[model samples]
Target: MKKLEIACFTIASIKIALENGANRIELCNQMEVGGTTPSHEMVTEAAKYDLLKYAMIRPRGGNFVYSTEEFESMKKSLLDLKEQAIDGFVFGLLTEDFQVDISKNKELIQLAHPLPCTFHRAFDQVIEVKQALEDCITCGFQNILTSGLKQTAIEGKEILQALIQQANNRITIMPGGGIRSSNIEELDRFVQANWYHSAAITDGSNTANAEEIQNLKQKLHA
Candidate 1:
């Protein structure tokens, strides 16, 4: 089935996306920094709903690589929200040289068991994306959020297409960064992916406007 994961930075945006037909959510905070862990209140409230929800587990957004302490914090956050209704958590980790941190990622995925896991846009920063994809698969990622290693999904659509073809249903290739109503229809025609991700933002406010979300759905349907 086709799906959309709205990256909502605020509770208001989450509601707007849900009301406007978003089926899944990537709950986060500090959109300016690529997003970070949401507040406990936000996670608690979001879990009360029956939607497919994933809380962003990023502690700080400078880079995907984490220090020992930072990794410990991510562990704590995941454990704290263990009993929530969240279907999964979105997270990523890489080494200094941009290789997949297979050991840590495997551990984290194991820790997030039962709740499926997603490797977020940190995928875009990897050096060997194809190998990394296989690594995530081995680590048991339910899906991966990426732009095919480009700055935006549109610019990366060619590589995204290749990645999708290579995946061949092993995992979902969710087009994310820089997605908008204006470009999504064209992107759909190009990528033909089953899943798409966006925040439905139409402005710098970083809020998911209901009208924008509706327009996005209509565009996909068209």
Candidate 2:
């Protein structure tokens, strides 16, 4: 069956996701600028829950490129979160020229070790989608959260489908960005990805809507 992974920005969001039967959650903070790493305290609290959780490892919100200090921060975050009950890690890195920073990404993926890693939306900004997908696979990422380089999954459904076909099950191409119950069926009808991601915030709030999360999961099951 298809799985729904909610982008949870707060502890409340995590609760809502769990209560509503979400398959998994991408836990992070500062949803306004995409997402950054959640605090150690937040991860500690979230770890108490009985759901699959993937912690975001981004240090900031501006771009995929990072300075040496920022990269070090990511490494630190990953190491610290690994001590928690996190099921996996989500992150990505790119060169100034928008190519995948394979070396840096591989380093973090290695640190993540037995736990899988999902290369986040930074995949959208790469200059070459096909090459970047291969790079993420080479870097040991188990999944890639992306919108097929488009603003939203629906708008990019065609490319998303092509990606899935190209991936051929070597890696999971999770379609995220602007995914919601209202449009999930349409997007899935075409893209047919194994996983779908969304914040499930219908009220413009950082917290997820329980009903929205349920609806998204229900639609995926349907």
Candidate 3:
């Protein structure tokens, strides 16, 4: 069956996501700036809940490229959160020229060992989607959250479909950016990805709308 994963910016959103039928959640903060790493306190609190959660490992939100200090900070954050109840890690590292930094990504995936890893939307910024997908697989990422290198999953559905075919079950191609219940069926009809992602923030707030989350889940099953 298809699964719905919600991008939750706050603790309140996580509760709503669980109660409303979400299969999993991408836990992070500052959705307005894409997503940054959540605080230790937030992760600690979120761990108390019974749900599959992947903590975002981004040090900051502007871009996927990181400075030496920022990269170290990401490592520290991953180690710290690994101790929490986080089920997996979500992160991406890119070269200055927009290629996947295979070595760096592999280091984190190894650190996250045993737990899965999802290379986040930074995949969209890659100059070559096909090659980047291969690099991510080499780095041992279990999933790649992308909009098919486009701004939204709907607009990128064609590419998303091609990606799914190319991946051939080597890794999961989870269409994420701008996914919603209204367009999910259409995207599924085209891309047929196993996983879909959304913030479910219909009211333009940081919190997720429970009804939207339910609708998304119900529609995915329907």
Task: Highest lDDT: give the candidate number.
Answer: 2
RMSD of 3: 0.7
- The digit string of per-residue lDDT tens for model 2 on 1-222 reads 999899999888988999998899999999989999997777887888899999999988999999999999889989988988999999999999999999999999999999999999999999889998899889999999999899998888898999999899999999999998999999999998999999999998899999999899889988
Question: Which residue pairs collide in model 2, if any?
Answer: none
Best first by lDDT, ranked: 2, 3, 1
TM-score on alpha carbons, each prediction: 0.97, 0.98, 0.98
Against the reference, the lDDT scores of all candidates come to: 0.88, 0.92, 0.92
Clash count (model 3, backbone only)? 0
Question: Cα RMSD to native, each candidate?
Answer: 1.0, 0.7, 0.7
Candidate 2 worst ten-residue window by lDDT: 39-48
Tell how far residue 76 is off in model 3, in angstroms.
Answer: 0.3
Cα lDDT tens digits for candidate 1, 149-186: 99999999998998899888999889999888899999
Q: Report lDDT (Cα) of residue 143, candidate 2.
A: 96
Give lDDT tens digits, candidate 3, residues 54-145.
99999887888899999899999999899889999999999999999999999999999999999999999999889999999999999999
Return the lDDT, model 3, position 183: 91
Error of 3 at 2 (Å): 0.6
RMSD of 1: 1.0
